[model samples]
Target: MTTAQRLPASLTPLDTALAAVLRDVAAVTPVELALTEALHCIAAEMAPLRAHPPQDLAVTDGWAMRANDLVGASSYAPLPLTAPPLWVEAGSTMPTGADCVVDAGAVDAAGPIAQVLAEAIPGQGVRRAGSDIAEGRTVMEAGRPVLPRDLLLARAAGLATLRVRRPRLRLINIPGGEATAAFIADAARLAGADVIRSDAPGRDAAAIAAALDASADLIVTIGGSGVGRIDAAVAALSARGEVIAHGIALQPGRTAALGRIGTTPVVALPGAPDHAFAVWWALVLPVLDRLLGRGRRRTQALPLARKIASTVGIAEVTLLARLQGSWRTLAIGDLSLDAITRADAVLIVPGTSEGFAAGTDVDAYILRE
Candidate 1:
């Protein structure tokens, strides 16, 4: 049977529904970007350049001389210099014919005359060429996100630019009167996508089709994804193309929809601000990462400071706050902006388990820019 025919007029499992949403997603093409502008972008291939120090240099501020010249030298029987010793600073190239550096405190010098009071070994206190980074070494691997330190490494490797992938997203606000559009746009941008937003008055199919016609890599609708009469995002998506899944087994976001319009992927989020944010974080962001060729979000395990109840058959997402060195679930049923602002993490309660009690360990996904 087809995927749509398998729907049971009930909520679908979160993982199963998300898999359908991502099945049709195609990764964006890679493009060359200046190293400075490649931050947060995924690298298309291994860095091609190499970083090799050109010459051997001194690693300490001292006097440069042949090691043989300092043999048998000690404090009781100091060895006087036959000729002036060459002075070298840290990171300075060694003078010709010099094989070692004696610490400044080990040698007593006055003008052209110097006395060596300690033994020296060849190659001591010297940094060899390519010691830090060898030639032909891989600086960065493909599918790795470009970070600030990665850029520095690329520059040090003689690379002026790098090939990266950045997904372009088109956001359509169905029932556009809500104020959650801006928040959605910001979240998309934070996921390393270039976003263009459009508003459709009360689930107008024509407006959504027009936004799809703009030819973005992916299209996202912010509202009108429920069973209510005004919830027409699913119908609009069906009119344009195929609807993959209509209802996910997720609290506060069970009405989420996923589909495709021709070759482009589309995600329909619920109207409530908190529900929209939850669906975006749990479902849409993973698909966006695939299109952008980026890595998955990082998660950490933490103990719950209090009890959190949930239905046995439905997955629930709860806002988390770090209070007094422990994670506490915020009160649900309030979708206000203030609640979101106060949350530092997000906790997901699985559908198979009844719920988590105080001191039970749970995985928390930390929110970051």
Candidate 2:
């Protein structure tokens, strides 16, 4: 019988299944790598070795003078300086007793003395010491993915490397599931996982079982998750290790399964693109976050532009688009390729709740940076 024709024997609650998937899974060991190598990896706590702008510095290429010396000095009535003020270039350390910088034209260094024609404020055009980065403060908190802007701060602080955690993930693609496998691989990489992808030799339980490798921190098998005659991923996992959950109470991903080979966690995703996509967000992300020690995810609070009706017994994935400062519901339950492609955020409706009413303020996870 086909998967559509067969009724699931029992469905495990999404929360129960997720908890099992994360059981005993610990964060990967953190490593200190060069900034170039740590890009996109989860950042470990980083404290600046030294403060930025080690001393008071000039923010402009001009003359550095005490503000009091240049006060009330203007073009109409120039103030003659006892001596030419120190000339400092942009980013250069400001001279002692100089709390402000004046442009070149503001000071005329002709004849026997220099005349100042610009009024200056105490801190005008000056970058104070430790203003950019403090010595005792942490450069970045742990769990946020390293970004280019983060590298800028590290470079300025004279740091050659940063500590980060990158979890290794293995993706097993069953025969005829290349598209979904590739899609999931890209998404995993975007989430800072080091993805290793391989194809199962055949469709049988033995072939899928042979492809399972416990070396990776996590293993995800695509396809063969349903109860159809050809579906054998769950059986393959059971043969090698214990299956935690066979069926999950997730719309479009009900056939998904969770298991473990030895200590490494394993997840079997449905072959369909939409179904796999839902499972990736709902089930797989939690496992990935746990492995990487990610603290929190980006979420946005916005009112719903339309009402969302979902069955109370099963968890549903809702795709949304940001429009006119509110979240516009694009797809719920069975997601289409177009809807998934156009979605800017995702909201999961719990099994206990009936649905969210229109204009209800909801917190949805941001899909894009």
Candidate 3:
């Protein structure tokens, strides 16, 4: 009899397992790199300082003068503005002797001398330095994802580079191209991680041992990690390292393995694109945080719109959708099929359900953008 076809890919079970496992896999990657290169790095703590205007800057093109000069001046009894104040354009530095600036438009220009018709409030027309941002203030807090804007702020604080968590990344199939290593290298580039070239000695105990001896923050294995007879990844790790998880109960991706290579954590993932993609977001990411000494992180909640049938005794990470204000099932297991990321979040059918009906409310685990 022909074998029954199972669904392609999923994230739920793997995400749950990762959540549990990353807690135990502890280490931290501290990196000091230029802000330009701090792509995937996140702020480890709030910046110790904030940026203030280098000096007193102007907000508008106005005349700098003492505030008391315009107190009695009004539209009717316009004060004869004299040489005591200086005429300057917008963005010019505030003169040391001047206390405030009057908007050029606010002055009645009857001749070379401008007269003030309206009462000029003290510091009203000027932007004071240190007002928007105070020095020595904490700007970015720990656990905040480093984004382009955050980097911009860091630069403004007179920082060209920042101390950040070194990005942790693993790509299976790099040496063997079992699944496709170069593709992962490309994706890692998009994710802001520089791909570290790696290889398993020869896909067995001897090979894995030698590679483990090599310097690497993360280990990437391509192919050879499955229940199948030729799968040597599990056997190799069995010699020196224990498998944190053997089979994640998710189809196609069930072969995905998480374990240690010597002291360094290793990820043995399916070579397939969709399976690898799902595991990358659900497992590898959080595990990276653990390895880098970051506090734990979890996916934000998005509502589930549809029910999905999952295998009994197995956890299902259903890939679902939210479209036109309703939740819909997109696919079962493999989301990397060029179809699934269309949805905002993935539906996590807990490991215990057999299947679900339409309109089932389940947890939707979000992914990093």
Best by TM-score: 2
Q: For candidate 1, lDDT tens digit of each residue in 1-369? A: 112212347778888878887886767899888987777777776654554565779999999988998899999988999887888999899888898989988888855678898999998988777776677776677777788888877776777888888887888887653577888888887666778888785455555555554478888888777766456677778878888888888877888888888878888888788889888877888888899877656776778898888887787888888878788887443345676888888766777878888898887888753
Q: How close is every model to the real structure, measured as TM-score? A: 0.81, 0.93, 0.79
List residue ranges in candidate 3 displaced over 4 A: 1-24, 27-29, 66-76, 96-100, 105-114, 121-125, 167-194, 199-214, 228-230, 293-302, 334-336, 354-363
Count of backbone collisions within predicted model 1: 0
Better of 1 and 2 by lDDT: 2
Model 2, 1-369: lDDT tens digits are 323223357789899999988999999999888998888889876654677788999999999999988768999999999976889999899988999998999998886898999898998999999899987876588999889998898888888989899899999999988999999999998888999999999888889999998899999999998877888898889889989988899987999999999999999999999999999999999999998888889999999999999998899999999999999999999899999999999998988889999999999999988
lDDT string for model 3 (1-369, tens) is 212222235433655667656644665555677887876565565456754665676677777777877788877798877764577777787887576778666677768876887676667656677775677775466555567887777776777777666655655452454445665566555544546756765655457555543255666566666554445666566565766676676654677777776566777766666766665655665666565555544444433465566777565556656566555777776565655547556655556777777655555655435
The lDDT of each candidate is 0.78, 0.90, 0.62
Candidate 2 overall Cα lDDT vs. reference?
A: 0.90
**Which candidate, 2 or 3, would have the higher lDDT against the true structure?**
2
Query: Which candidate number maximizes lDDT?
Result: 2
Clashing pairs in 1: none
